[model samples]
Target: MGVIPALVILYFTIKGYEDYFKDKKIFLSFVAGLLAGFFSVLFESFVRNAGVVSLIVLIPFFEQIVKTSILNSRLARGTEGAPIYGATLGLGFGSIFIPFSMVIYASRWSGLDIVGLSIVTLGAIGFIFFHGATGIYIGYGVKSDRVW
Candidate 1:
């Protein structure tokens, strides 16, 4: 259940990392990924009780806004800025989830075994790709136009 997703997350994150390095925007990448993860979890949790629909619709918009903010903060004006910013934000969202997932797994497994812990870690990695892809799209929009 978990390892498969972990592999997925690893794949996308690695790709994201490559993009970050290729552009030589380490600071932006790290910060964006960190911020994405932080904000996604916060926003997701806050809206979780409200319902999945609300979370799905609202979170993406918020995600895009947050992503654009990061881009606007560091990079100079350019066409690629939006995409680049979005990618970094996606990475951030994915990276942060990894640890939280591990904790969640640990709690689930409590005193019986380590499977829960392992599962969470793997699951978290899977989530990384999901979030990363989202960031890419959101950032792409922000860069393409002043949608935000």
Candidate 2:
């Protein structure tokens, strides 16, 4: 459920800028997003363990920086498709991040039936769009030589 929406957004985003990215760069950006998602989990765990009361406030800052780190690298900087690449990267990040989070929630909630799972999936889809939209903005910023 989560995967389908993410793929749809990815397909359309890439389709809109189909000529901008080669297969290799797209793949690399997606992989970077996945890595960012993984690291976010680790960082969140560390923060939780450290008893950080301001974690909720800090998450957005932490996530945006970590998630877009790859886009700020030299390879991405050289590309004319920075916006497309950033959106693609965010697609990858949200694809992994949302589903992993939903699964963890489902696991913890013993009474989560199909209805509950469906709700979570729906929420995940919303989040997928949010991530993709933010990525587009980030990419646009990069392309315009503006810091975000």
Candidate 3:
């Protein structure tokens, strides 16, 4: 991913964290949820063997659910913080994936033309934004009592 994409992701993440800090209890829960969500995959060999599609859907689902629960629970008090919480989760998750993505992209396309590089940059930005949006929606839903 290009620097611009990375920055955008970072911006959202920071925003999410700021929201969570509005309630320290909720914020701590979010941190715990994120860590648990992030590490949950490591202990599950079965999911890995379930194939690529399952792995792709399951891991993110698990993380989002856990985070949403934590963030949403705080909404009964107020929803003012949902956006930040969501953005933070997205940013955190994206940060973890981006470096590896950059390495793989650079290695494979290092010799490609500028057009190829541009494609990679765009893809990265799109992916990060998509992830950020997902977080935002999920958190917002939970906080607003619109959905869970």
Candidate 4:
């Protein structure tokens, strides 16, 4: 149940630009994003009670750092397709993070139904796109030597 949505988003996210970056590097970035997602889940366990501030600031800050960590190195900077890699990395993160999260948190609902599942799926889509888009912004910054 949790795996399907991420896979769909992942396929569409990298379909266009997958050829621009090396398969190995793309796979590495995806893996890195997955690892970052794992760290995020760990961090969430600690900060789940910190209120809106933690949700608005700390988690995103951590996510952005980990999302760009692969590209921050000397090897990735000034590369030809920063946006492509960034989108892939972000897609990878979202693919696992959002679905896993939604499934676990969905239990809070009284009972699961198609409508409820659909809503959660929509949230997953939005967040997956958010990560992919933000990755592009960060990637461009890394490539151009300018932070945006």
By TM-score, is 2 or 3 better? 2
12 Cα displacement, candidate 3 (Å): 8.2
User: Whose lDDT is higher: candidate 3's or candidate 4's?
Assistant: 4
Stretches of candidate 3 exceeding 4 Å from the true structure: 1-49, 73-77, 104-121, 145-148
Local accuracy of candidate 1 as per-residue lDDT tens digits, 21-117: 3455644565656866676777777786787777777876776666656666645224565554455556665677766666555676665256766
The estimated TM-scores of all candidates read 0.62, 0.83, 0.54, 0.82
- Candidate 2 C-alpha error for residue 123, in Å: 1.2
Give every collision pair in model 4: none
Off by over 4 Å in 2: 1-4, 48-55, 146-148
- Candidate 4 lDDT trough over 10 residues, lowest sum: 1-10
Number of colliding residue pairs in model 2: 0
| Best-fitting candidate, scored by TM-score | 2
Pick by lDDT: 2 or 4, better one:
4
lDDT of each: 0.60, 0.73, 0.56, 0.74
Clashes of 4: 0
Using lDDT as the yardstick, the better of models 1 and 4 is 4
lDDT, model 4: 0.74
lDDT of 4 by residue, 15-79 (tens): 87755678787777777777777777788779978999998998888888877776777635878
